[model samples]
Every structure is written in structure tokens, then in C-alpha cells.
Target: MNTASSDQFNEYASIYEDMSQWPFRKYIEIPSVFQEIGDVDGLSILDFGCGTGMYARWLKQRGAGQVVGYDLTEGMLNYARRRAEKEDLDISFVSHLGPELIGQFDLVLGVYVLPYATTRPELQAMCADMVRLMRPGGRLLTLPIHPVYDPHPNYYEPYGFRLIAEDPENPYADGERVKLELCKNGEQGGVFAWYWSATSLERALEQAGLRSLKWRELSASAYPDANQAPKELHAYLQRPHSIIIEGVRG
Candidate 1:
């Protein structure tokens, strides 16, 4: 990971676990990821780029046989480890993934991971790592920022977030960087992430030997009490806030 991105998330570690429960993540991101993942009973799973191990814990709660969480940021890994210890959940949260992890998982999933790649080579390497960790026929699922999303200055208001184009000049041209500013009831924090189009992502995955790419939009109905969700999120019912990418190692 690049220094700036790493620092951003490392700084975010202290607040990530709490911030994650915000409506957007609780309603949209988590549900969408689980929908794509379906069932995990008795499966060995990897939570790639797992920040604070929230999904890893969820997997264990849902009866996954084994779960390993990996993150580049030390703070994130520490927080994840602390949580695992507190709950006595049998999860291994590691700072890195080495050769020993290759082909170790039946299901590998990442949330908001790919956009951290920052460059074509980085993105390709990230895909290669994900494919490397999966057993043949094992699945790879990811939830990432929608590539085609055009951020309007105030469009994110309903979600209590803002997206600013750091380099307005030539922004949204594949692999460009975008800044995501988070806010909830007046508190503020944010992170920088790379932008990747669907076409480019597919090419990278194919290059890494993953096949049968399937794209699914995040659904509002997937959220709990969908009818009670804010009107701002209603817009996402028509337009996507994020997407689920599912593929298989063959």
C-alpha cells in the first residue's frame, strides 16, 4: 500500500469499529457483501484487507469453520486482534499474508479493498494475491466503490459522507484517486481511495486467473428495516452506492 493510503487507514483504526456501524455501512455495505457471499457454514474464509475484523467476527458467529483476517495497517490488525481476544473468537488477524497462506481459503472476501491499489500494477498485484489465496473453485467476493459513480458535491449528504476529486483535472479517468470524507452527526474523518472501472477490474482479475465474473448492485432491500432507511438512501435503490463483484478461481 502507498504511504498516504496506509497512513489514512492507520489513523482511522481507532474510530473504524465505531464508525462502521453508521447507517451506510450497516445498511448498505455489510448487507451487500453478505448477499454475495451467501452461506459460510463450515468454510475456511479469509477476510482480505479486513479493517478491525468486523466481518471475520461475523463469519465466526455464522458458523464458519475457520477465519483468518489480514490487513496491511498495524493499527487495524491490532484492533482486530483485541476484538478477537475480547470475544474469544477463534480468528487469526495478521498484518500480512505470506506464501503459507496460498490456497488456504475456500472463500476470500474484501470490502473496500481494491480501491486502495492506487496504480495498475498495484491493482493487478492485489488481484493476484486474492486469487493466490483461494483453492481451485473457491470464490472471491469484493465490495468496492462503483467505478462509474460521478460524485456530485452534495450527493452524499444523505449518507453523511462526501467525495472530493483531489485532482479535478482528469478525475475519474481510470485509476484516479478520490478522497472520501466521512461525517456522522457533525463528527468528521475521511480516507483516500483509488478509482477503478469495471472493464479494467475485469481485465486485472482475468490476468490473475479468476473467471466467471458476476456483477451485482447493492440492494436496499438487503438492508434491515429497509422501509425505515433514510430517503437519501432511497436514491441508491435506483442508483448504486457500491457494487459486489463475485468470481471464481478455476
Candidate 2:
């Protein structure tokens, strides 16, 4: 990740927990993420790019064995560590990709992590990192911007964030810059990330020693709060802004 990206997320660290409370994330994204993760009981796991330790804590509480969270921003890592301490969760939070974490996890999960790679080589390195962290036969479950995300930035404003195409004329071009505007309850901030085409994403994972790559659409209807979700949820689901990709280490 670039300095600008780290600096941007450091600023967001203070409000990251609040943003995680957005209704879409609460009612849809969370369930979708966990559904793909499946049973974590006794499984050693790595929460790659685990901002705020949200999923790491949850995974630990759900019986994941030795859950560890890794990220690039110290601000984010500090928040995650503090939260883990407060919650009495024994998860480890680290900022570096050291040898200690390699080939040690039964599963590697990265939520919104791949997008932070601002270049294809960075993306490739990240995918390779995920593979390195996982033990043989371990799985990877990650979320990245949907290949068909809505080009209109404001379309998702109602849900507390916006996805702006950095290049308005060519939003979906491979490796194009995409700006994310996160807002809610009078607090707001934004960040820049790059978009990856489905082909590139798959190839990155495959080249990094992962196999059986699959993409699944997140459905608000599958959430337990589906009935309580507002009408806009259907539209969000129709043209989902994020997607799930899972594979096993070969």
C-alpha cells in the first residue's frame, strides 16, 4: 500500500468502527462474509487487512483457533489491538508480513483488503501473501469491489457510502482508480483504491497457488434481516457493489 493510502486509513481509523455499523454492512455484508467463511471452530485463521479487528474478534469468539489480524496501517492495528483487549479476545494484531505468519493459518480471510492494492503488482503480491499465510489445503475467502459495481457514485449514498469512478469516462477499465466515499450520521471521509477486472483477479489468485476460484453475489435477501431491510436493498443486491471470491490453497 502507498503512503497516501495508509495516511487516508489512519484518518479513518477513529471512525472505522462507526462506519462498520452502516445498515448495509449490518444486514447484508456481515452475513455474506461469514457465510462464505463457514465453520471456524478450531481453525487457525488470518484476518488479512483486518481493520478495527471486527471480524477477527468475531472469529475468535466463534471458536477460531489462534486468530490473527494483519494490516498496513498502525492506526488501524492499534484500534484493533485496543478493541481486542477491551473485548478480552486473544487475537494478535500485526502490521508486517513477517515469516512468523507464513504457512500458519488454516484459513485466510481478507475483507476489503484487495482493493487497497493500487497497482496490479501490488495486487499480485497481496494475493501471494494470502497464499503464503495459509497452510496447505487452507481456504481463502475475500471481498473485493464487484466487477459490475454501479458507476454512479451517489447511487449508494443512501447506504452511507459512495463509489466514485476516478475516471468517469472509463470507470470499469482494468486497474482503474476508484474512490470510495464513506459517510454516516454527520461523519464522513474517503479513500482511493483500484478496480480489478474479474480475469485479472482470478489470474492473480491462481498464479499465487490458489485454486477453484469462484465468485458469489451477496444477497440482502439471504440476510436474517431481509424482511426489515428497506426497498433500496433490492437495488443494491441487483447490482451489488461488492462480491465474494473463495478458493483453496493448492
Which runs in model 1 stand beyond 4 Å of their true positions?
222-230
Candidate 1 weakest ten by summed lDDT: 219-228
Pairs with backbone N, CA or C atoms under 3 Å apart (clashes), candidate 2: none
Q: Candidate 1, residue 169: CA error in Å?
A: 6.1
For residues 1-250, what per-residue lDDT tens digits would candidate 2 score against the true structure?
Answer: 6556767888677677776677678767888888778889999999998988889999999999999998888889989999899989999898887898889999999999888888999899989999999999999998999998999978888888889988989989988999888766554868888899899899999999999988988866464564566776866766778999999999
The alpha-carbon RMSD values of the candidates against the true structure, listed in the order shown, are 2.2, 1.8
* Candidate 1 backbone collisions, by pair: none
Candidate of highest lDDT: 2
Q: Any runs in candidate 2 off by more than 4 Å, and if so which?
A: 221-229
TM-score of 1: 0.92
Cα lDDT of all candidates, in order? 0.82, 0.86
Per-prediction TM-score, please? 0.92, 0.95
lDDT of 1 by residue, 1-250 (tens): 5556676787677567875677667777777778778889999999999999999999999999889998888889888999899999999988778888899899999888998998999999999999999999999998767875656645676677776677777656788778888775675778888888888899998899899999987765554665677776776655565688899998
